[model samples]
Target: MTVHLQQEQQTMLWTLAMHAHDAASTRPILGDRYAADLLDRVDDPPRLGLSLAGNTPLICARAKLIDDAARAFLARHDEAVVLHLGCGLDSRLLRLDPGPGIRWFDVDQDPVIELRRELYGEREGATSVAASVTDPGWWAQVPDDVPRLVLAEGLLMYLDPEGVHTAVTHALTPGSTLVADTVAPWVTWIAGLQPAMRAADTGFLSSTNDLAAAAGAVNLEDELSLVDATATRTGGLTSTAIRLFALASGGRDAMVLRTYRRP
Candidate 1:
């Protein structure tokens, strides 16, 4: 049986649908081949209009960038811990399939985690924690000793400023790496203007023009422009438009993927 999701939780389905759509395309960027199968199981999947469909490339590109960084981290560390905060129903654990030494944790709200469990049964090295990232107690469930890699893809903006700060500070242990994607302040405002977002009674709660200011104390290790990544992964007019937008000042930061390391 399928589970019911609240409006906010429905956002995960939209992203999953985007990944599934891209996988079926001729040249897929993210190449999450399992996305289509997962999405198909949903009782009523979200229908993507031009606006949402147009974002497929960017979303898939972001996923691809995160996957690459995650794979590299796993390669460098013999035994590691991965905290996928706001993991939703994405098949990241299955996609990466890290070896025995790695302990992977997929964290999310209680309801979302419930559905995820239904979709994905138990895996050897993976554990699903059903709790909010903002809750301090959830941190206790994760080990403090192991080297950590925190992934917060498409997660931070849904949180208010204080929540963002709390989650970040708690996630960054010594020698840990964090990879997250954030939209510019203007995009956050624009997201609020979307009719669909309003209808769903959900919208972006916070955004940061400068991630350094928002994350606090972490050293920025790398940054990738979603626009640039999308351009690189796509072709023809889509690539041209993305490249042109990137050329404009501050355009690359419009939606950025940032990698930070804790000292």
Candidate 2:
């Protein structure tokens, strides 16, 4: 619907764009059925031009990667605890619908959580926490001693380097898992130049090519690439460009998803 959000929160528009795109794609990346239902409820997602076009499929791919990681974590640890940090209006708990044993928390700012309550309802195992992720107070709400799966999708760049470290480091447990998407410095630069971002008064303030290093994770595994998945669906010059960008930047290292094991 017609929810009013601040400039920083307008980034939720990208979730809408990817949702609509995935629903419309021939080979839908994430196949987010819930996304279509939400789109029907929200206002028109603003046209972000090239950034929207390029990032839509990538966002879907990123979501898919996160879903896969969660599924894997859940498969191994039935007593898993999921924390989706900086969770916007997007509905991941509904998409996954983890078991009753798993305690899932969708964390975000008070305003967005308030909006979410109007737009969405309480889930059985999933609870929405209204607090800034940077604030350590909210961290106390989550339980300890479980297979924790912490997801920070399109989040860290909003926080500076120190905030990113604190958020991730706080959740790092020996057996816990962290799945995150980070942009390289070059990608951050391009995002700032985007018309849509400038219009919304939001831009990536922090970026790193190596998320594992930034998080100080002793064990790390690279997960998915936006270019890799999107290139499969692309053709002609578009496909060529995807390929070239990947090669030019060491296989789209600019924007990547990774899973880190807390040692």
Candidate 3:
């Protein structure tokens, strides 16, 4: 039951990210089933069941990486707000115990939001908004006075360069910090090699050779880190597929984590 949306590719990645989280939670890597159930709510049960048998390890690894970052942010800030831009069915709010002080917003398309509502009962301190991240209106609901930690996992590659810029710029507040994961441009070419990947979505690979430049475009002071899932043996289907893709595409494109903050 694939639900096609304006950004279909991005949606698929979001689902994939959720699946990864589910794998991690159920298997005790992250030590909870909350995130897994959140993912289960939206996933095509039969299709995911088949994939899990073979890809659980990969999925768990990717989930752990994302969970680690989310956990770290919650740990450091008592009043932090987590804005999961393009958040599909991820239940990070359920997975991390935020001590009743943190707020979590899950933003995505209307249909996705509806699906989440139907599948998972809403919890306290967690809200879902149906809006594009590029739209400025969504910010009205977020408290501007407090610190915000924005997570854009597997999101930017499907947005045009300008759209990504606008989303980052509009989402940024004086105390905002952004945690994003993206691939290098060459990785995009490699991603196209897999037939399954090519069928997923619409958007340009707006990644740059210099992640700092991309972040700077949105007025964020960027600190970039490399993420080689292969080196860490934590590569998921997408990560492994991207690695094979890099070989096929004939380049050295790498995965990266770019953290943006205001200086």
Q: Could you give candidate 1's per-residue lDDT for residues 1-263 as a string of tens digits?
A: 56578767877888999999999989999889888888888887888877778889999999899999999999998799999999999998989999999999999999999999888989998999999898998798787677899999999988888888888888887978999999888788888777767767888877764456666767889988888889999999999999998999878878889899987
lDDT (C-alpha) at residue 149 in model 2 = 87
Which candidate number has the best TM-score?
A: 1
TM-score of each: 0.96, 0.92, 0.75
Candidate with best lDDT: 1
Clashing residue pairs for model 1: none
The global C-alpha lDDT for each of the candidates, from Candidate 1 onward, is 0.87, 0.78, 0.63
Residue lDDT tens for model 3, 1-263: 35444445344434554455544653334344554454444434334334333444334444556678778877888887888887776656666757677888889878878766876668898889999887888788898777888888667777777777778776666778787766677767765664444445443467754345556644544433333443344346655764564464423335556677753
Candidate 1: list runs displaced more than 4 Å: none
Say which prediction, candidate 1 or candidate 3, comes out ahead on lDDT: 1
The regions of model 2 sitting more than 4 angstroms off are 48-50, 233-237
